[model samples]
Target chain A: METQLFVQIALNGWNQQVARAEKFFNGLSDEAFQRTVGAGKNRIIYLYGHLTAYHDMLKETLGLGTATHSFLVNDFLKNADDVKANMPSVAELRQYWAEVHNELNVLFAALPAEDWFKRHNAMTDEDFKKDPTRNRLSVLLSRTNHIAYHFGQLVLA
Target chain B: METQLFVQIALNGWNQQVARAEKFFNGLSDEAFQRTVGAGKNRIIYLYGHLTAYHDMLKETLGLGTATHSFLVNDFLKNADDVKANMPSVAELRQYWAEVHNELNVLFAALPAEDWFKRHNAMTDEDFKKDPTRNRLSVLLSRTNHIAYHFGQLVLA
Candidate 1:
């Protein structure tokens, strides 16, 4: 019930989901990663890139630091997959995935417990004050669910 | 953050996901609901039933009440879908989904804020003491992610 404990629960859930996704993608072959979940649906590669791009932004969103993989934003986040678009190699994206999450892990670990209750950069102070639920921990919780949701789709790939 | 606020965030996340999924499924035609996420993967109807069955069990898991749709457990929860299996009609499962969640909304609304910190029926007292994060709110948080995960898959249908 303490703030530290509450923050720990949110962080643990985020870590658990990130681990699950990492393991799932790590075990996938490059060919399998290229396969779409279904005909004409987003490819596994795109989802992997999408997740990496989103988490890369989480650094800024959480007020931890700037995004390390900002270049991926236009390709993966701004647009749906276009088979002809220039994109990173699966190998490159794999490395980005590791680096981004590893960096996030360290940043997240060093975050003071009380900071989790503070508003992230994405929210206006006025909006966050009106609904305190839109704090940093809430972003982590929502993004944790976001990862799980995508992981669910990835499993069907 | 206070315990009441933390609990509200978790419950609100759960409600938001449930509403998203409910809207998605409600808008789907029976033909679309019957379509599989991928070849030989879960059908949307199966996921709907599975979610209903899982939420039905949440009543007991949260120690709010016994499962009202106990009969759905074996078909929807314990076993993978079989084309030949005697499953509920799509219409029938749709009705169950609404009923189960509606009942859960009432039960969840009545739960005291402090009670969210208590261990549910699923965990032993010693286990809960060892890791208080495994409380009723934790279960809700995990299940909220579970729904989001499946909803991610369902959208591909």
Candidate 2:
């Protein structure tokens, strides 16, 4: 595969994952959003916020855009997937999600193909050289899988 | 993007999803496999079987291979997602999962790039002509997302 085409497919696949989420969530009732699934006992509202929080963090992490949910990192990232009382409501989280999704898509659309191969997140030159797979495009691709994981769970919810 | 490279990357991505599922399912304990999520409601075994059955059908639908579980098609396919009393044991389902997964991977690996562009499953030539998006490669790509969706749910299990 030419590097350009390879990157484009990855980018389109990533966007498709996002679109799947929007399609899955579109027109879902508010009661449905608050529904809980699994023995873990988390509500869909919490998962939606958690998903949006990750995207918000990813925007900053990949330098595609700025972080929109600096407040959510502690509650959502590395935290157990349990329901938290303080999570933003489904409506607010959806707005945050749409914002991050729009900006990230724009960033991806505007990105030069070469930029996909650039260093990402907090990695220094030496860090990136040692693990070239940690590049910006890799971040996009991995986050795509991450989003898919949550969407699967949502369907069950 | 050259069509060949685009198809190649798509193929590799499809296999990567399989590898991820194998890695996730490899060492799961029998108890864990049967463990119920959604508050003792849905069992992992049912979900596993459902996932495998989908692949078995996809192999035939994409013309990659024959169906390994015609018997399972009636129960697991369009039926409800709930756990069933008559469902196969975890080991038996695992065997089916492995068989379908292996054969499907082999089929995908050997698929000609041009075939990926051909019409798929129930789509007639006339339908494919109207909406080329319903081609074989599109099926593989969509199923890749399907696998990811289930994997997300499995991790919770």
Candidate 3:
């Protein structure tokens, strides 16, 4: 597959990584996820929500995409583990995980090949015209990096 | 750029993530890295070498490239923290990190655009002919996920 077809190949790889990361999460002990991990004070659950929130936010930024976990944005984004008392249940977070991926998968599969090059959500025609790099492909590339970064964290957890 | 030239765009993003990960590594305190991270028995140093060695091995697997850290493959690959006594010093592993990345950057830049779709190192010409999916693009995609997965692990350190 060349460029356009490369989209599906890339998307498949991303979905696999998400599955791989969730597997790591599933293997973790409850206490382990609740405690601070590595150098950061954030617990494993915080990172989980952090990742979910990122995908949810991406839904808005990428344009033409729907978010599955808008409710997570406030408590999880940049909150880290500080608000432990208010954090969502692990069951709810796990549900958000599946919902986010499912939503993205359906939404993405429906987008025609040309749409991958179009500008996402909030950017205006003039803004996109000025900065052509902020297209759908660029967002896809960034999200892959984002998920991989978190996947690495999950490995440690 | 479309699919073929999309190589460079993807490469640029991978490089930026590597830079971002290295920045995180550079910021860690000595004690923090030595401590057990999260629920895993492995330490930060092992994860560091794990990532570097993966790229090093990928260098050979994807073909037309040489591994920079051959010494590390036996020790770091699949060994995990079990062989900590035999593991390379943190300083030495850090050196391998830079060496492996430098080696890959030079090697990849030299490849022609079409080389990306060519067969990888070990796959038989006949086999690859049957399964064209195992081309240079797939290798590139896998390595990107690998690095991102490991990069996430480093964030915890």
Candidate 4:
């Protein structure tokens, strides 16, 4: 498919699923969010924080600045207790998520169709070669897809 | 993620999306299903045939018995009219897809878990290894994911 087609399809999928997660967590109590689930693999809190962190990294990597921080990496660097203690309040988390979601939507909506095929370096220094038919748009869609995939995991957990 | 978790998560995502696609296509009209969404890409009819063929190949590659014919490969060899002029009716396509899906699920369920990690020779005589915890499952999931990824294209078209 062409660059435009890929980005539109990806955005449609990402918007639907991420909105679902946002609403589900919006009504949850802080204590409930922190309660371990799935044999401690992920709690609701960790899932939210991880999603925020991951998207933020992708945004920054793609040259779109993000306000969210990477708690998963931070937890690894510091301690689990510190990560837990730094958890955003439910309202704060909700606002941050909405901001990120809307910010991303704005970014996607405003993207120049031509830039969709422009080559750029990924965070890993992987050189993404450019081809007009399906290039940078595919890469951006790939990042959004990362969000959609993890959103499914959050839903199941 | 560890190899085991990575493989399992990948498998879970693959199966979940396939189930969604199967359910969606089950409700589509025969004409709609056979509509030439494109060439060298999935239409609903071509996808069913392609996925079944790949699963059969996977079984054979794993030294499991043949469960289905590789229709697309043979058709290409014979220069048959592509799905363009020769698409199956929706019912036939659905039946073929269901049969292949069932066979794949059963075959996977029956495999010894250890086989996922066993090393084997590639058809090209290259050294190949299967890590249930990593390699085999990743490849298996990719088989479906590659389909799902393209299927999204079919739907969008």
Candidate 5:
């Protein structure tokens, strides 16, 4: 296949997979989602919350947000216990997760092909030097699999 | 699109994207691939290595290999320094990378749609309550974007 055609097909396929995966996730019950198979384990609710946080982070890094980027995985892990302590009821959590999904759709749709290689603005932290253009998308794309990976685990669990 | 059609398209697209990304990565300088940036500070080389590891891991998980399944990310991280310590001259790394890419093609070509979600006879350590079936093809479909993500990063960097 021609390169452009290949890319188009891949992008279309991604949208379809996301739609299906989202629906599957939405179908879970709060009890099923919240069940801790083992103590301090990753319940469905926790996984969704983590997905929500990371997607938001991707949005911020891609410069798709009006607000500054504040969500860090470290911060989430640091506050993991606290976040889980106040875990929303399953229904409420699903609603939040769906919103995050919608946000991802919007951000991805708005991504300009021309900006695909532009370096991102310098991160405030000296430690971070993310090339503004491509790393955001790369990291974002990796997280999509990350979500799928964990979701697969949750389904199996 | 219909669910089956969507999955098929995803599979094709993923396969194509990995090829495109692999070519793009292979053309880059070792220094370029090794530079650290972004929120995660991951380099291009690191991503290339991880992709290779995950491809092999998926093959094993799907029972495509006689070799026992190895810890995916763990082994890569553990051997990260040694793997990079005497980095093959750029030419050698590219050759190695191409071999993996060829292996990916072979793996993809052999995968049947029906086998995408089939559970393996050997139980995985994952906490699955039941032996659920999943298309092994789904993982490959999802990983296409994962490779693209890093490719985008390399371009921007």
Candidate 6:
């Protein structure tokens, strides 16, 4: 397949997962978001926030822009869900989720086909040179799966 | 990136998920497999068998080989888990999981890079002509996410 087509396929997969997540979280009730995946697992709210924070970081990770929601890093990314930790309300998280993905969609579309194969900010130049498979497209693919993984947990709520 | 590199990345993602599922399931106690993801959702055994059955179908879906575990289709694929339905023992499902993925790993590695871009058995020639993105590699990518989705549920067990 052509390189452009390959890039499109990867992007399409990412977009599909993004859409699924958006729809699922949008429909969830505020109370439902408080429920854990199991008796003692991450709550739906935390997963939603964690996903949003991760997507926000993708801006810098992909070298397209800066992370707009860095404030969510400590609560949603670095630490697991804590009842005591200050968290955004479900309404605020919903807004942040939409904002992060909306901005990402634009940045992702503007990325040239060849640029998807280039190294992202997370990889060292020498490391990327030695292992070119760890490119922007691969990161997108991994993140796509990441969303699906968490969405699985969300479904149990 | 080169086409070979693209194929490698997709396959690597698939393999990584497979390894994770293997490790997670193997370490789980037989009793744990009986637990559901939530209070009334799919039990871990059902998800294990469901994933195994899906991978078995991939053999034919990729046009590489025939399914070796067609017996699992009706219970694990065509229908949801039923308390009254006859099911495989946890040990049996574990064995099937290993067999299906082990065989697939061999078939997948033997496939040429260019072949990954070709249409799979599930797609029509006309549809594939209009949309080449629905190729074998795309199926693998989707299935990779599928496993990750289920793995998320499995983790809650």
lDDT of each: 0.90, 0.73, 0.73, 0.54, 0.53, 0.91
Evaluated on CA atoms against the true complex, candidate 1 attains a DockQ of 0.80
Every candidate's DockQ is 0.80, 0.33, 0.48, 0.03, 0.04, 0.84
Question: Order the candidates by lDDT, highest first — what do you get?
Answer: 6, 1, 3, 2, 4, 5
Question: Of the candidates numbered 4 and 6, which has the greater lDDT value?
Answer: 6
Instruction: Give stretches of model 1 more than 4 Å off.
Output: none
Per-residue lDDT of candidate 5, residues B1-157 (tens digit):
1223334545555665676767777677777876642434455666666666666566666677632223335534446523345444556556656666576567656766445545553465363224232234444555665565455444434
1 versus 4: better TM-score goes to = 1
TM-score of each: 0.96, 0.74, 0.82, 0.46, 0.45, 0.96
lDDT of 1: 0.90
Candidate 3 Cα misplacement greater than 4 A, ranges: A24-40, A122-133, B26-40, B82-91, B125-131
1 versus 4: better DockQ goes to: 1
Question: After aligning candidate 4 to the native by TM-score, how far in Å is the CA of A57 from where it should be?
Answer: 5.8
lDDT of 5 by residue, A68-153 (tens): 22333443334653433755566765666677667767766776544433444435434333322233433444455555545544
Q: Give residue A91's error in model 5 in angstroms.
A: 2.2
Native-referenced DockQ of model 5: 0.04
TM-score of 4: 0.46
CA shift of A22, model 1, Å? 0.4
- Worst 10-residue lDDT window for candidate 5 chain A reads A1-10
First chain TM-score in every candidate? 0.96, 0.88, 0.86, 0.71, 0.69, 0.97
- TM-score-better candidate, 3 vs 5: 3
**DockQ leaderboard ranking:** 6, 1, 3, 2, 5, 4
Clash list (residue pairs), candidate 6: none
iRMSD (1 decimal) for each model: 0.9, 4.4, 2.8, 17.2, 12.9, 0.8
lDDT of 1 by residue, A1-157 (tens): 3777788888888999999999998999888887887788889999999999999999999889999999999999999999999999999999999999999989988988888888989989999989998888889999999999999888887
The TM-score of candidate 2 is 0.74
lDDT of 3 by residue, B46-147 (tens): 777777888888888888677767788776786657644677877787788898888888888898776777888869999988877677777777777676
